[model samples]
Target chain A: MVLQAAIEKWSGKIAEVTIGAANAAGVIKVGGQETLPFLFSEGKIPNAPRVAFEVWDVHPEDWPPELAAAWGENLKDPFAWAEACVNKYQAQALCLRLQGAHPDYGNRSAADEAKLAAGLAQKFGLPMIVIGCGDNELDNAMLPAVSEALNGRQCLIGSAAQDNYKTLTAACLADGHSIIAESPIDINIAKQLNILISDMGLPLERIVIDPTTGALGYGLEYAYSIMERARLAALSGDKTVASPFICFVGHEVWKTKEAKVSPEQGVIWEAMTAAALLQAGADILVMRHPAAIEKVKQHIENLMGK
Target chain B: MFIIGELINGMYSNIAAAIKEKDKAAIQKCALEQIKCGADALDINCGPASKQPVVDIQWLVEAVREVTDKTLCLDSSKPQVIESGLKAAGSGSIINSTTADPEKLGLLIPLAKKYNAGLIGLTISAKGIPQNRDQRLELAATIVSACADQDFSTENLYLDPIVMPVNVAQTQMRDILESIREFKIISEPSPKTVVGLSNVSQGTSARNLINRTFLTMAVAFGLDAAILDPLDKDLVDALITAELILNKNIYCDSYLEAYRRK
Candidate 1:
């Protein structure tokens, strides 16, 4: 009560923020809260988990062949590929995905993507997230299958949005899984989705908000500001917007040239890619390269301690 | 909706004297009243009371514990008082708070782990409450980092960004609201965001009316827990109604039932 009274006494006057740490296995602990984001002083924040590497179903022909070479033969099979990502790469969690299911991509069926999600979860022991390409219909159809397949494992379904929250949220509610509520780039819209989900009688703790991200050099700061603003609302007790957040790090990471292109064409950008994400308030980073994962994990780990 | 009773603290002279006299009946009465009225927890603030704050805290905690199984919200500025409260509580308590104080950051953190107690981290630095959102977040960041460093579970800490009065600055509520949202996004899955529901409506006409309005808005900002009087029908009614409007409770059934009883 003294802390609260003093904090309330000093609310707008203080100027320091804290970010928390990850565990040995990389699950970010809830402690070590302090004045700076993720620093170990202002308060207590505990375990910090490692990053979740993004894996796609449907061989990413769009991805450079060099990228495909990293996974070897596992790239061809979603289930095998996810297993390999976890076992070989020491990935803390897997973002087994249905990127190709988008109409513009593979245009796969909900059942098909759901089956992939089921297979991946069954085959991989790692905590996983099932991501769908931004197609409302396909996501609605497929997310439930993913939810049903994972059941009590507490998987995070790809998303629910203003366009298609009803179906996706229902699946998450039914399966005892969590859902990510994404908004294009507005704090108001982000808050609205959270309200919508709460309106549906789902637990706020079970949902993670993704204030949609933009690539670096392409309005990422706006996303950062929005995340910061949203967090402020949560701290102030806005139940709608206070849930934990999720960021599509790989999606934004890959879209940035610094991550996709090499140093010969430009300055060494891989380092920048990892650094940029850490700076952007990313909690669960979904990355691509083994090097980036290790780099980000290490950077995050360093921030966790003295 | 966690209601931490604000009574039995030195902020009120009668409460201070009762504890000094070791008036178990007086302290027990507050604790039981809160629990019977559905208080999830009771906040015992030992403000500027006894010279032996820690001893007083221990006695009050033990006294309250004897009377009710309801959890204690150990509130005190003195680290020793907090430590004594924790020691007295033994287990399952809520640290009234640890602030952005550098030395205090790591202080109550261990107590929380030791007692498995939930905590409240106020967003204020040694310089005191920030005047703006940036300053407030800075303090919040520091508090969250302290928790992270200690390997304290984020969920265990309730980060209160410190809501100031709307009369002094109308945007004060808005600023706190924004900070609550951002704190959650950044803190993510750690530190439950909360607020002192009474602060926002202070000095406003029809205080209860203002409090209810502010509570609804705060809930929209993603409020998970609030510290307020469970006895206030208007405040309680507002929470139930707000929950329904926000779709927290279905079809307003809970709201209607709550209203009927009131």
Candidate 2:
């Protein structure tokens, strides 16, 4: 018998999203696959998956020793740290985590963090993803100011959840920036949040979905499966869950005990987590270890068959 | 859904008058309006009313070609009338039907291959319509096998199980739906499925309701094409909603508009 190819003739496609300005120095595009990722011979895969280095506005107190030592004293200053990542580590993009602005963590006000984001964007001039502290009230307060700070630059700002998407949606619309719509690793919630955000009149092209994932020893399978399903649904033509996926690989990786305490294993743990996410159809990976980012980039290039 | 806009048929008095008068503007308006209302293709039929269906179909095809390059379904049981329309159909033409009757298939199957047009084969024969799923399946397999033997691609063939009026053949409705699902298994690449949707609601008060509801049920069974009134907003809405429920389309607040815009 002549063997036949078991290719899927899918009628739907994941939404291809542009994260940075058309004229930006380092613009990134993802998620225009007609088939599942990296099935190059089966369908069209336009843009390759990418890696985004995560930075922070305030000093990260609980970082793994390996990560802490890698950045050294630059972690204290957001601008210097972001500059070092691009100039040294070849980070395609940077995600500025404003964890310190939470009411519990030093209570730095929204305007102060917005100032830090503005300064970092001007200094680094690379595509930046500014994320809030996951505090609903504080995120509602801070993200609007940051959205205003990077109005013309087409940067990615996030995360609007089920209860708190209106403010972030309004801010992104007013400032002309992309948004990261985060769902708690549930496909339905992920789809619903996208519907809610797009309902506010933000075009689907500027939205990236964060179907929140976990580290390797953690709930990795749950996150992995959700991301995979979202990608499949998108390719199968569900517009509500069709935006490009963005996973915070570094934040989830560094928070794990393996990355923090396992000596030699800690270094490889971050890479393993990121590798799993990339396989799960993550368009952009936010990771900590420089080696992991480099290794994942190489792996991504291979997976894309570039 | 492969909607074949059923407006330009001469069965409609307006279209009949337009066809009789050779009013290209009226026929062109019908074509443009149906295309605007989300018709994937248009069915050109001179109907029983036209004294000269062959001439009318040729003229109607030319009129529609003026406004858009969308696909034309040259709908007729007669091979000569379909052949006349095919001459004027610039491209993207599909032969509307051939019954499993050997004489009809012998005439239309070659036209389908000669024009390289997509074909719809009714699971019907000279002996009359299939009364149940087995009868429909038997006829459908015969049609598929005949197309295969004729070197016509089965993938381009659409099988219509010939929907009967619900008021008369109520029990046959489920069997019709079942045949639509089973027809795919008869070939390697699987022939597509279609229905002359409004036939189910003939002689009924709730024509639109029955048409949309049955159409929805058929969609759940993997219906690929339909020939009905694209102007029926409720019927189109039911189709779009059915596709969304089936996870075939992405949900947007303006999904109704989005589906039409596509």
Candidate 3:
């Protein structure tokens, strides 16, 4: 009951993390930490789970048709679409996916992605996260411009891999942006990338880790274990691993058949898929369905009871 | 590299009493002592001593700001206290935390944004305190991501990996070692990584003695800043020694100069 009580109390408060400049915009800070991840009462949760609405640079061709369908007319304009995610869905942050920059996607050049990102920055005053195509080289090229274009605003720039960190890290340093260093779900790799970034002489506080989440039935367990291990490392005073963790919850959820397909596929599939990922360790989820985000938030709140 | 003296926190009785009585002398004494000893900043925590912590904190922040231009580390869980302190500070200050709680993120990040203040983000989140380096790393990622959401400047954010007592958690040092090592890699362009040097030795005998050694080891592992006693010669020396060994300081000249000044 004590653990239960603690969990309930802790759930009410969301954790905070500040990146980018200590004094600049785009600083993400989680304020209340009532308990350990999911453990309530040990700490306090003062904020609600913040949401980030997703948008893409170009029309997504490979996405599950259902996801593409959700965006409908909004997909044509990144700015309007971003506004919809925030204004309509009450998203606190915006996730601008440079899907077009992908070689296999729309095949847009890095410069094109950067220019689009710049436009989004001009359009939205709220904090935004710019995710690059998975191509390391293109990400390296595109992120720097995005960082510069959003200078002083403190945007989050990503798809920064170990191999391509130098370019992106330099951009962040020059432009005052925070970054997410992603790694395959291996704990060691996650730690290694964190070290690499700092060793390049950047500060540890600016970087967050994306352990690479999987759909509920896909590799959620692995993501859970990776995240759990990373958090443990931070508490034990590993300043490097102590930055914070991020989950691509929406990306994973939308990709899953349960979330993407209709009830004819399986009546319980949608609920089951969303619930499973929430259990696994999703700090900041980027979701497509407003209802799904609400469902996950409610489940999290009910479980936390805070 | 701004080391905010953390002696004013409520966890200490003398400081709490001073804050309660509105004793400027006591507060001034602590402030001057740390500054004279080499602190770049003084963290003023009002504790839970008043019915309205924000008002009391405002008074204290003004009091401390009146004496020094050194930046302040505003430590309080309440946003109002932080806001009051920020308003009263003579210079930009560091938000003691936006912890890893999801809800608090919105409240704390905006303050950092509004005031153009530096921040300290704790690694522990809503889940609870992590027990090992891996979990700490996960929290570190969460902290950075949350900051990213707010658009906080990466250069200004400092991450405080929660440090438990090694006496209770023997592997804490190892955890810190691994976490810092990992944190450095994950943090792009390295955000400031700091720790409360005192936490490692709490409840242990020969605290200062233990603290010095731990501080040295932590600094070696990329600890950029420490919330500690500027007057502690041994601890200060240990940090200098670490800098020299790490070749962080071009020569032992800076170290010698510090020693000579003392």
The model with the greatest DockQ is 2
Supply candidate 1's per-residue lDDT for B257. Answer: 41
lDDT of 3 by residue, B74-170 (tens): 8888888898899888347888878878788788888888888988888887778888888888888887888887788667888888888879888
Q: What lDDT is obtained when candidate 3 is compared to the true structure?
A: 0.70
> 1 or 2: which has the higher lDDT?
2
The positional error of residue A115 in candidate 3, measured at the CA in angstroms, is 2.9
DockQ ranking, best first: 2, 1, 3
Which sections of candidate 3 miss by over 4 Å? A1-16, A19-28, A31-34, A263-280, A300-306, B1-262
Give interface RMSD, per candidate.
9.9, 4.7, 13.1
Which prediction has the highest TM-score against the true structure?
2
- Mark the 10 consecutive residues where model 3 chain A has the least summed lDDT: A6-15
Per-residue error at B156 for model 3, in Å?
A: 36
Cα RMSDs, all models: 13.8, 3.5, 17.8
Off-target runs (Cα >4 Å) in candidate 2 are A109-111, B5-8, B14-40, B50-71, B78-90, B230-262
CAPRI docking class of candidate 1: incorrect
Interface RMSD of 1: 9.9
Indicate whether candidate 2 or candidate 3 has the larger lDDT. Answer: 2
